[model samples]
Target: MSDLRDPAPYDALLLLSFGGPEGPDDVVPFLENVTRGRGIPKERLKEVGQHYFLFGGVSPINDQNRALLEVLRKDFAEHGLDLPVHWGNRNWAPYLTDTLREMTDAGHRRIAVLATSAYASYSGCRQYRENLADALATLEAEGRRLPRVDKLRHYFNHPGFVRPMIDGVLASLADLPEDVRAGAHLAFTTHSIPTSAADASGPAAEHGDGGAYVRQHLDVARTVAEAVAHETGVEHPWELVYQSRSGAPHIPWLEPDICDHLESLHAAGAPAAVMVPIGFVSDHMEVLYDLDTEATAKAAELGLPVRRSATVGADPRFAAAVRDLLLERAASERGIPAERCALGALGPSHDLCPVGCCPARAARPAAAGADSPYA
Candidate 1:
């Protein structure tokens, strides 16, 4: 459906991602970078940083991104797709601004950004675009050459994104005891955003009303469940659950936390459960701490069998999917509307995010929108 042979509109690919601390020393600084303008107190930040501290002050995301980068590079080479790839993070070293400066100085223009996030929610989508815009503004102020940055479309429903997840769910189910396999439930987990933001996700969001954010997750959960049922003939019942919610309790957020859902399933006598982290691309800190540590502990207490499936980290299929989207976008840039691959009903998201799509704050610059900042 995509042509890996052409990358005319894009000179280089930037793997834009949410950065994490590499070590204990980087924890506070990285946290500060993430919460810089939000005025979050050091005390609260320290509380949150403990999660990273527990894991030796490192978040698995950076290294995971590195692995993905290598895979993308290797896949491109193997497929004869000659495109250079660069990386930068929003909250850590090799920061976005510095990366942009480096790319511009290296004489690369018409950059295509593939954010690690694959959905349409605020944090997953808009915030990253805003981060890219801010990085561009900083570079512009520093007298750097500006590159036209276009983001790839959301791939929540894309088969490249979904197939691996189905495999993951099936693997997790197989891990359950043979006696319990037929009755296992699926808990599809994702990061929980504020309900207001969730409502405002995607185009023209107006309230905490479950916009594209919830819809996309549900579509994926259903698609995976249906496919798993078809393959295993087990008809696993599944629910979309939220995780890593950090806002004040007064501010509503996506709920039925994974652990809580596990408790309910246990009480309801579900023989076993598979924790499919369909929401995340990697076993990031949230997946590591929240699912691996916290939720696993809860399941143990309930005497419920559980297995947390691996995320799609550097899966060859996923890397190829990225290539497909890149080529598709490049083709469209040259006036060819290439066919897209999406497993769920939503299909592929907009190449250019519609105006008012996934706003994280009341005011901010965003790229790939109507009059995008990158434009």
Candidate 2:
């Protein structure tokens, strides 16, 4: 009998995340780190930093990641999974390179990375891989033995990820007035990338017409809506919407922003609506500022009753799902059969990202994939 809990051949798990500013003084530097190569002017970046400044220049992401780390450690310990988990960020302190060096010094040879982003896109998926590759390169230059790193598949459709949103939608609907409850529409929201990037998401062959990014999001939205319908006995009309778009306005990006969608719903005489942030893993800046502050204000102006649903922040179910994912991948690595879990029509994502998966505008080495130089 195979013990599924054995996380062998994987000495450590890394909680890879897109880090944010911790304080007012850290905001500009953090933004500088994010926009390093973009050649954007410093004043322009300061303009962008205003969003962070509004909340005293603090981003909720780092704190949420901290909470998640605690939850994952607790979950692993309680479930008898001995794998040690470490965290690293892309655009802030405790940077990926420094964390990798620490992990190597600590003698963790085989590492499995769980990125905070849960879908397939260059920024969401491949860029994280690129960061890992960059970190490994630094270690290699320093004459340190680089550990083998592998990223777990996207968990957007995992029951542990989706079930919470479904419950959130239900809770939001129940909170609405009785007259508007049945007429409430569902707005499934995610970060909006450029259309070109969206088209290039996922494997090379799958690129085109929204590709895996939009498709995966639609799948999760459908599953959540169906589950909500089943639980409430009311079929709510839902539409997948986009939010938190950055970059040049001349370039095309995903459309029907949450605020716009709310306006349209109001014009259409929809009684109420629920903003389900299916794209985010936690209630980070995007969710906090974009949805809660901006969109909520828009809904109020339009006299549209709106409720922003909860994210899977520090949820124990998500922690258990991470454990399940690690064990399943470990089992597969050991040439053992394991049941991969997911929801919706997309099924489980591939364990290893294939060549050209979520290709970047400029080609670069990405770790933990078919084309990884480290591999």
Predictions in order: lDDT: 0.88, 0.94
What ranges in model 1 sit over 4 Å off? 1-4, 205-208
Best by TM-score: 2
Query: In model 1, which range of ten residues has the least summed lDDT?
Result: 1-10
Query: What TM-score does candidate 2 get on C-alpha atoms?
Result: 0.99
| Cα-based RMSD of candidate 2 | 0.9
Error of 1 at 259 (Å): 1.2
lDDT of each residue in 1-375, candidate 1, tens digit only: 244368888999999988899999899889898878789988888898999999999999999999999999999999887889999998887788888889999999899999989888888988888888888888889888789999999988888889999999888888888998889889999999888888888888433478888898999999999999999977888899989988679998889999889989998999889999988988899999999999999999999998999899889999989998998899989987788888878877889987778865768888766747667
CA deviation > 4 Å runs, candidate 2: none
Query: Model 2, 3-83: lDDT tens per residue?
Result: 677998899999999999989999889999998888988899899999999999999999999999999999999988888
**Candidate 1: what lDDT?**
0.88
Flag clash pairs in model 1: none
Pick out the ten consecutive residues of candidate 2 with the lowest summed lDDT. 1-10
